[model samples]
Target: MSETYWDRHGIYGVMAEFEDPEQLVEAAKRTYAAGYRQMDAYSPMPIDGLAEAIGFTRNWVSLVVLIGGLTGCIGGFGLLYWIAEIAYPHNVGGRPFNSWPMWIPITFECTVLLAALSAVIGMLAMNKLPMPYHPVFNVPSFAERASVDRFFLCIEASDPKFDLEHTKAFLKELNPEEVAEVEK
Candidate 1:
């Protein structure tokens, strides 16, 4: 196969749909046991134990926020320090050139502004947002019942252990109402 063929066909994984949330959770556990890593679960509402069943871990949003806040704090202080001490130093009303108190408001504002911007950008980048299309959206039934009553589990094509036959059989064993092979 050509590189493009592999790029298009290599990421073959099964999408299993379930009627009951509990069954979906159980199926997720079984899928995890079968060594599928690039899998996701969808539900009409949050289901307990689903995260553990699918081995989903907490995201790194907090770390991103912390780094952003720290950077903002440092940058704010540095900018104010440079302006007050080096750039156009002035002794207004006999106050010192390095006026720490006067710089507090600007420093605070800059810190908040940069931190908020970083948080918004970081979240978008981390989640891979702004995607124009997805293969899951191509599944006909997927659009009909995704938000109403059905639950879905999809194993992406990028997973290292993904095999068409094995994945189909694994999904079948989970007793899903329907198992569909998605193409991108």
Candidate 2:
């Protein structure tokens, strides 16, 4: 039998609780500087530069959305062209078969529809949604305070620099109110 990830680590990581968002941001920056890559922070509200401090530089969501929009635009225009000129060419009211003016509205509508749908699907896929469970939620206080008025920084055990005792000590040095182990 093989040891599972949960069994191997026996914990998710060490979490430090902070009362202020400033503390959370500073702690995250120090953790990142200490070479801890697999870490996350939570707060009641958005904190400017917090993500940058944690080394979150790039987001592929915009690229995904752009590709989706371009695809939609090209596909919509192509479909309209095929339908109007080849598939069902109708000589209605002496209008030309390749009348592009009338196809503009439907083509624009199709473009918007596909672009919107792709954006939604892309976002869901990128974020790995439908996650009904997470180890961070295992903490009793985290469940309630996470969305209210507290900030938290969790250093995952999976990080290369993570040593149970050493990481705990490191988090403690950050002067947090409390440091607790996160269970899997």
Candidate 3:
């Protein structure tokens, strides 16, 4: 194939191929301890402790969804309450205008709808999705085996401690199958 990216512009990082997820997790732990901040791991399956090993354990998507749901619930009820009790009072069947029971269904629906929507939208926003392209894709043959039976760890050059030769040596020290450069 054509030389992808790092060849033309600059190096993206170093990628190491491992036989299994355990090895990848160990390597990630070592890299993290070595002060490599910008790194990621890919495995055929969800590898437990991998995220923790890489030092990423915080997320706020749930909080965002909760806030969205509450806002939707209150807005839904308030809007109808304003319309029925304040804006234009419609006395139907001599029923009370401040009929909280009548507004339950719409408020519940709004809460569910906003919660679901916020979960999806907040997750996407938090994760910065829709990125159809990433430098890690240029790691040779990563596309084929990464989702099959292999695990890969990439230490990005953007990490402060990253020096191409040093990073390559570091990955090799992890006893991976092979350590290679990732093109941008």
Q: Which numbered prediction scores highest in lDDT against the true structure?
A: 3
lDDT of 3 by residue, 100-171 (tens): 999999999999889999999999988889789988777757977888998999987777677888889989
Instruction: Provide the lowest-lDDT 10-residue window in model 3.
Output: 1-10
CA lDDT for candidate 1: 0.81
Ranking by lDDT: 3, 2, 1
TM-scores for candidates 1 onward, in order: 0.80, 0.90, 0.89
Which candidate model has the greater TM-score, 1 or 3?
3
Model 1 is weakest, by summed lDDT over 10 consecutive residues, at: 1-10
RMSD of 1: 3.2
Residue 58 shift from truth in candidate 2, angstroms: 1.8
Error of 1 at 108 (Å): 2.6
Task: Give the alpha carbon lDDT tens digit for every residue of 101-135 in model 2.
Answer: 87778777777787788788888987788789998
Q: Can you write out model 1's per-residue Cα lDDT over 1-184, one digit (the tens) per residue?
A: 2233324663445688999999999999888898888889888898989988889788777788777877887788888889878987877898888878877787778778877887888889987988888778777777789788999999876777777787788898888889998777
Q: Which candidate comes out best when scored by TM-score?
A: 2
RMSD of each: 3.2, 2.6, 4.4
